[model samples]
Target chain A: MSKVRVHNLFISLDGFSAGTYVTADEPIGDARALFGRFDGRVINGVHHVAEPITADRIFASAWGQGIGAEIMGRRKFGPQSGPWDDDDWRGWWGDAPPFRTPVVVLTHYERAPLAFDNGTVFHFLDADPATALAFARELADGGDIRLGGGPSTVRQFLAADLVDFLHLVTVPVVLGEGTSIWPGTAGLADGFDIETLTTGSGLTHQFWNRRR
Target chain B: MSKVRVHNLFISLDGFSAGTYVTADEPIGDARALFGRFDGRVINGVHHVAEPITADRIFASAWGQGIGAEIMGRRKFGPQSGPWDDDDWRGWWGDAPPFRTPVVVLTHYERAPLAFDNGTVFHFLDADPATALAFARELADGGDIRLGGGPSTVRQFLAADLVDFLHLVTVPVVLGEGTSIWPGTAGLADGFDIETLTTGSGLTHQFWNRRR
Candidate 1:
């Protein structure tokens, strides 16, 4: 059986997922100070979980403990204007992006296949939330499938009660207004259980595992 | 009299102000996300003591409200190994950086005077922390001297008990090891008192005021 998980979804105090004037060039605002929380090899270890590399290096002692597949919304894939123009704008990351394993991108517009040399293939699914979860479950192969988000997508999955676990890295600065993960969403309080709460680097990393 | 205040200084769980591998190109790791909390213009009007500006706008109407001058350490100004280079590499911001006031750089190496067309001047100070504070005090003209940090410089001033107030944005990510602001060489617990704490966007922003 496969499990669904959402990881590293960021939010601002005013319920905005991102700043309003955000563009492809400036995906994040005041990014330097906000991202300063993860600087050393520690973050790299976690990032490598999705990146493509030799199996030895992928599973090497240097890499963090656990991570399976990645799932994100199209907004995170690129700027939100045109449908997929060309393959040139793959993402912020260069040729070999951070995520190497199977990645699922949720979108309404239909697009052709986006294949990269590093085993990264952009699979665009127009199916509903249930269909996406089914595909993720199949891909998980008994492992955990991460829900990489832009807030709107995460809210949809959470509303459906499809996520099994969540790891939120909450940054301190607040935009006060933008896109938020919790607004207009409901039913999250039912089956969710907080597994652990830890504090480090002035940031609070919370983990919640779904209760059966 | 110039009052010195520390604002938006982030810390790690291990007491490292920033991780070990801070370079000139990227002074603070994960800094983008750290500052993301303040990116939105909507929240800017509410949370920020300062007003928010559009992305295209460089100068804000409330640029010099609480901030009288900008202060930073040498490493944050440029690379660590090189001697005092020319003003080519002023602080990260380009020619017309955001700060429209006297920007001070704390450095041991003295170089030729560098001036920008905009209201930014790279004033290098060789004197001790007290001298630098005095200069900023005079420059502030009764306003607060904002302590823009790189940790070590902040630690020095904090050790001398020169800081009047401190604002720490606690992001919720654990690097497991890195530079810390509070538990630095000089114990921050000794003189600083946490005056206020606000939680939003999964981050806890703490304000520490000097006991006086």
Candidate 2:
């Protein structure tokens, strides 16, 4: 079965996953500290490192494994809200996105799909978590769907019980107030088995796998 | 110097240190899951176990080391609020509380000191964080003071920058909504050097030491 997975979601000690403001200039806005310690090398297995890959890298490497499609919020696709007037803003990742798979951008506006030279393609759709998952599933081609997030998007899918596996990295910083993923998720832990690992770099990684 | 330390403070993934509504029947209320995995042996030393003590146990055993007096919120002492009319209700620990030292309970109302055979003495006073810390410092007799918490009390000391060391245990659970210790603490981690450790039992222990 193609699982719905969320990987490498960074959250502050205060449970904030993203900063309040999101502009084109500051894509992540005030939440830059959330990703300050995040090394993008984890996405591709960290094979370039001369030192032996640590457990954190191994756990984070799961982000790209067997993922054929990614379902992300419109804000994650670009810092634009409402109708997408700035059509040139492909994404923060530029023309060639690292996600070489079909990406479903959850938005209320209707826009033509943007295809990149790589396998990355962005499909804008106005749909709920289930509908968005269905769209991504068709393009996933039997592989799992990664739930790419900007906090609110992950919260939506989690609230709908669509997430099968979650990889959350808890940073030690305190962002007093920001976008939180744990809100309204009262007994979300009851449905899954959680494993926690703290790396030497002070990042606590949690893997939540849904119980069969 | 008599340090102000907090040990074994458990919080859910949502940063809720305690559940709402405390009663005699349910002392911890809806947030019992936060303390579900807590072993009392960690407070002292887990020497009773024939096997070697894990790093988590070693880290947790610091609770009893070099601690003389404790300062806690009124809620941590009992469920009753506003003037203690029930004189018979000594505390939740019955006759013998684990705190075998002077304990200053921050309250608006004053009550006669309650002395226990275990050397536990409850001193209720209407004081702020600084005043309460002064009272505890005097009682500590040069020993470090432990900041016993029910969440809000910790936040008070943290906000006042009175806390010297903090031992926060992040449990794998979501309380959804409850009493949090992270509110109003925008940069609580800035003053401290944090060390993260995850135990085999899926507990993430964060030790935040004041950077002097």
Q: Cα lDDT of all candidates, in order?
A: 0.57, 0.79
Q: Residue B197 error for model 1, in Å?
A: 20
DockQ for candidate 2: 0.05
Best candidate per lDDT, number? 2
Q: Tens digit of lDDT per residue, candidate 1, span A1-212? A: 55666655544334455655547777664333345554321224443222111111111211112345567788778876556666577776678765666677888876775778876777777777788877766765554566777677888888777777665556667665566678655667566655332233455444456766
> How would you encode candidate 2's per-residue C-alpha lDDT over B1-212 as one tens digit per residue?
67888877888899898888899999888887887776632233321111122334434545554568999899989999987779898888877787889999999999899999989999998999999999999998887888999799999988898988888889898889899888889988988877676777788887777886
lDDT of 1 by residue, B1-212 (tens): 45676655655334445666666566565443444444322213211112111111111112233466877787666666457445566656667655566767887776755677867677787778889888877766556677777787788888777887665656555566655555444466666655333333444545555665
Per-candidate interface DockQ score: 0.01, 0.05
Error of 2 at A137 (Å): 0.5
Q: What is the C-alpha RMSD of each candidate to the true structure, in Å?
A: 17.8, 19.9
Q: What's each prediction's TM-score?
A: 0.44, 0.50
- Shift of residue B1 alpha carbon in model 1, Å: 50
Best by TM-score: 2
